[model samples]
Target: MPTLSQQLLAKEAKYGASNYKPLDVMLCRGEGVWVWDLDGKRYLDCLSAYSAVNQGHCHPRILAALTEQASRLTLTSRAFHNDQLGLFYEELCTLTRSTRALPMNSGAEAVETALKVARKWAYQVKGVPADQAEIIVCDGNFHGRTLSVVSFSTDEPSRHGFGPFTSGFRIIPYGDADALEAAITRNTAAFLVEPIQGEAGVIIPPAGYLARARALCTEHDVLLILDEIQTGLGRTGALLAEEHEGIEADLTLIGKALSGGFYPVSAVLSHDAAMGVLKPGEHGSTFGGNPLACAVSRMALKVLVEEGMIENSARMGRRLQDGLAAIQTGVVREVRGRGLMIAIELDPAAGGARRFCEHLRDQGILCKETHTNTLRVTPPLVIDTDTVDWALDRFSRVLSAA
Candidate 1:
């Protein structure tokens, strides 16, 4: 008979869509920055569910809020007001320093909501003609998996066979303010970009790229939308990655850690000029701002600020980056990232990143490969220096062997 892991894999392959190529190991439980497989093998988590578990897995505070709220109330559609929504709004708006917020269920939904708000603002506020407003996006951006979001992606895999794609989006090379300025016109509405491009192999843009983008957007009268879903809420040391550059975006999209992975809670936050155009009955989600999500998110935000997790993330990230840089392995071509969002790009001529990832998994460190040959390391914010050193030990061995 097959073991539980094998059985689960077989069942999934037989019953579900084969859309993912996950690592062979199966995680049964998680805490902080560690996970245990079904066979009882423990590993340090380096990916943190694509930065969703920044507060750590199953955090006691977030869990407490989730359980308490689950017992009290869960869903109450937007038709009537829920007691928790106002508190949620206050906490998120205050934390992010935004004038208004529109809650949604996923990062993709939040991105979509931002797009709609920008379009509406372009028409009503910016005095752009209807259906003529254009949004500029970068080449190596990964906003979300939604149809509209994917349409602007430069990756062939993401765009192939998924079109006829959505229109009104102009693509430009990232880190080039000139491209962005050239792409903008009288009908330009917004420029959407990811701070670090997590899915694109933790690609950090040139220094001052964001400041230039912000300046260009302001000059062009275009909204600057920063997709911080994968890099927000202390993942990159600061509360949001945008803080690293000391620039503010016209619109911000946050999710993943907003609920500490307890539930799907995402929000589109913007200044009054951008968000005010959204009126009642224009958009909503059945479970977007429910009592349960609101209560849990409120607690999650509290823990993130009060616990000093962002400071910890910064310290640990520096230690991890320094340690990885010390590894003089021939296989490593480059080591780059900001805060906990790090990446090790292997020599392309050597092979795919999966081999190294598999070896790391066997040595009790769990991480994921991205963009063919880049190994992404994004552990939970709660991870300490000792845990990071332990994972680095295993990583050192694996990279040395490779």
Candidate 2:
């Protein structure tokens, strides 16, 4: 008979879509920064479910909020009001320093919401002609996989066989302020970008790139939309990665950790000029602001701030980066990131990132590789110094052996 892991993998292969190439580890339970395999093997969680579990997995507070709210109310949709939605809005808006917010179920939905709102704002407020509005996007952006969101993608794997794509999107090289300035025209509606491109090997933009982009967007009257779904909610040692640049976007998208990995929750935060265009019946979601999600998200935010996870992320991130940098290995080409969202790029001559990732997995450390040769090493924000040291030791051993 097959082992539990093998049986599960076989079952998935037989029934599930062949969309993901997940590591062969079968994770059955997680808490804080550690996960257990089916046979009771332990591993440090380095990916944090792509930063969705920034507060760590199965947090007691978030779980309590989920259970409590679920017992009372779950879904009211947007057709009727729920008691928690208003408090969610108030708390979210106040925390993010935004005037308005629209809740959604996924990061992709938040991105879609932002796109629709930006186009509407362009037509109504910026005087752009209808159906002629163009939104500027950066290359290597991984906003989401939805059809409309994927329409502007420069990643070929995401775009191939998914067209004929939507129109009115312009692409520019990321971290190029001058390119952004040149791309703007009378019909440009918004400049959509990631503060630090998470999916593109954890690429950090040039210093002051966002500040310059913000200025250019302001001068050109184009809305600045920061896709913070991956980089927000204390993943980058701050409430939002935009804080590092000392700029605020006209529109901001956040998800992933919004519900502390207890639920699927995301939101589009907007200033008055952009979100004001949405009147009733224009847009909404069925499970967007459901009572359970709201209560869970509220507690998630509360715990993130009150528990000092952000500060711990900053301190541990520095330690992790320093430790990785000190590792003398021919395989590692570079180490770069902000807060817990770090990456180690391997030299192409040293095989690829997958081999190193597999080796680390064997040593009880869980991390995933992005692109071709870059290993993304984002542990949970709630990770401590000792765990960071343990993971770093494993990483050093793996790279040295490789």
Question: lDDT for model 1, on a 0 to 1 scale?
Answer: 0.91
Per-model tally of clashing residue pairs: 0, 0
Compose the digit string of candidate 1's lDDT tens values, residues 189-223.
Answer: 99999998999999998999999999998988999
Off by over 4 Å in 1: none
RMSD of each: 0.8, 0.7
What is the C-alpha local distance difference test score of each model?
A: 0.91, 0.93
Give one digit per residue, the lDDT tens place, for model 2 in 104-135.
99999999999999999999999998899999
Most accurate candidate by lDDT: 2
